[model samples]
Target: MSFREMTITLDDVLAFLHLPMGGRFYTPGYATRAEAAQTCALLLGGSASDYALKFDHVKTIGLRFGFLQELYTKALRDRRYGPATQMWLVHVVGSMLFACKSGGWYTTVHWISIVEHLDQVLEYAWGAIALPTLYDALGHASQRKTKQMCYYTSLLLAWVFEHFPPTIIQRMEVPDYTEDQPRACRRRESRTGHPELMERQVIFDEMTAEDVIWTPYEEHRDRSSAAVSVDGAYADYEPYLIPEGVPATIEGEVVGNYLDWYTTVSHSVYHPG
Candidate 1:
């Protein structure tokens, strides 16, 4: 099918859910084919959904479910359509626990399945974007590289469903740059490593530029490694947790400041190697 046809179908799905065809953060409102494509891409890829979920004002989880349901419908027609959708759904659900006035209560009672569904959604996302688009999304050195967080998040989301052993995850540590090896150098190691480098794995948390392309989605060492029972296991798999009692409203600012601090401190403390 042509790009126009595909986009039309995507828009129909978004409309079914009544989701606005619009920009996020920098851009707003669907204005052109390119803008619409971007909005669709963000929703399918999950950037749009994430921004909505971030706001405490987005009280109802149904809005999210409607979005996911639409994505699932799209996935059925073209698995790539849904699968390549953003991998941020988990974050979206998790944000609800914080975003909602009721805290985890509403999530536990109503939206649990959405949390559980992340594995399947993640598999599709990995299958879709884990290639050239993801690569192309990376800007050259002159331009700042796209934030590695989303790429790494996608990898981790896919891995969660893969039933990877806790040992593997624990061992799958991202290199800590502050110590002997900086994160950047470890990223270099991932890039330079010889034949069949994707097999040479690193911890999900240790992800860096060189390691962005490879994910555990395709190959699993052991099927039994999958964590079937959610319970606490899911918590272990998540990279970040909003500390209880930390106002979610302050989170954005705190996170921005923290990132700024981390960058400023990392640079000042250690000369780049």
Candidate 2:
């Protein structure tokens, strides 16, 4: 441990962590360059077993990763670490976590926090790694998407809402649970603030692959019903109709298949009548 670089080996630490200095030496969330570099070195050198064991030490904030019984049992008893050099188990774990986040698997803020708490990063692994791994395995489905993404969203939200540190929950402006809800007789009811506010999760049964359709919907999804057919034909959409507040009786309309008088006059069955 005595033999170290006199100056900050920023690239050495970054390369060891399998991290690319995206614009800055570290992400903007970190406090200082020294803090970030030291944190990266710690992560690159720390043992996974030690990391997992010391997770309980990070008492400042709660974690969001999911818990797997088998994984825990194995890691807890894992004395045979793979890498046997300066960059050890920490690099293996850190690289996996960083890849998952970079590949749009989980949130970025969590990794930044994890980097800051490398000595005791395992505790946050439940929130940061475990849960995200499960999520990525399942597919980054949006809440509004088919049942899968929706289910993921609910579990993720419910876990964060309920299991997250009371202080952490207070930081976010969640409709049900938040500390910043104005004190002027308008404070909202959060599960943590109000003990009775339990999240009633509805679990769905498993189905075959054919029956299951994964569709996660984003809030700002393009919901335009305007569609065209494969054969260059418009499917059920006629965009050339002129409105007259009533039945559009544009006789001899110069569009597709409108040869007869009645064919040209199409009425809007569903609209602002």
Candidate 3:
């Protein structure tokens, strides 16, 4: 219930392990998209359908997991914390992999679920596990808003997650700027029409000034759709993943001091729509 009351440690983060399957379970940790796809394709021979699925169902969430894990590794590699501190911090970040949603492309539930889990440990860590705070810790600075990347807005981490792995480009078909329709429609179309649109949806996500409000959490507006699965088949719905404890360490200095610092600084927890 209270920050001081919850003492978290490393086993907390490493325990996380589920996510919306990207259909590429075979992809190795260090493999490039092309390489991973090849392996995943070979491993994906188990199905009996030709869904013609193109884009990774879990790309955005996958990237988020990847980015956060990279930070986790970096913290360890940098020796930023003592052995015990490093262990738990790395586990805390590793455990975040479970927050992503999949088996159904992008969903508000997925986004909202991830956001909620990201915060589960915040109360224990004085909110250090908060995504925005992690991005800040990662030193992802603001940039000028270009047609490609967000400079000052909250889309920084998103940009990184969506575009960081250059390998993703090789997997895309081509850019399709379907001007006549909104980005959402294009994404729907991309599932078939010009799959390229869906492939790169995360990178060049269409955002208006109004989308800024979506940060931190997205509104759940599709309760009716819950009755049906992505394939229009009936299915048993699973509950959201549980959250675990997370601890914050800063070179063995004043832990509460860092909490005070993080609480004062403002940052967006999620990317703008």
List where candidate 1 sits over 4 angstroms from the true fold: 1-128, 140-142, 145-273
Clash pairs (backbone) in predicted model 2: 55-123, 64-127, 65-126, 65-127, 66-131, 145-215, 145-216, 145-217, 146-215, 176-190
For all candidates in order, the CA lDDT equals: 0.32, 0.30, 0.30
TM-score of 1: 0.20
Q: Tens digit of lDDT per residue, candidate 2, span 135-218? A: 553455433453433112333333333323333333234356222221111122355543221221101111223332222111
Name the candidate that leads on lDDT: 1
Q: How well is each residue in 1-273 modelled by candidate 3, as lDDT tens digits?
A: 112111121211111111121121211145444544343233222121211223244443232334334544665777654332433433344344223234322211111222223334233432223333334323432443322311112222223222223322322323672323221211111233232544555433433333332221111112222111222211333344334346435422545466545645643233335
The TM-scores of all predictions, comma-separated, are 0.20, 0.19, 0.20
| RMSD to the hidden true structure, all candidates | 21.9, 22.1, 20.8
Identify the superior model by lDDT, candidate 2 or candidate 3: 2
lDDT value, candidate 3, whole model: 0.30
Ranked by lDDT, the better of candidates 1 and 3 is 1
Give candidate 3 misplaced runs (Cα > 4 Å): 1-8, 11-30, 46-96, 102-273
- Residue 98 CA displacement from its true place in model 3, Å: 4.0
- What lDDT would candidate 2 get against the real structure? 0.30
In candidate 1, what residue range of length 10 has the lowest lDDT sum? 1-10
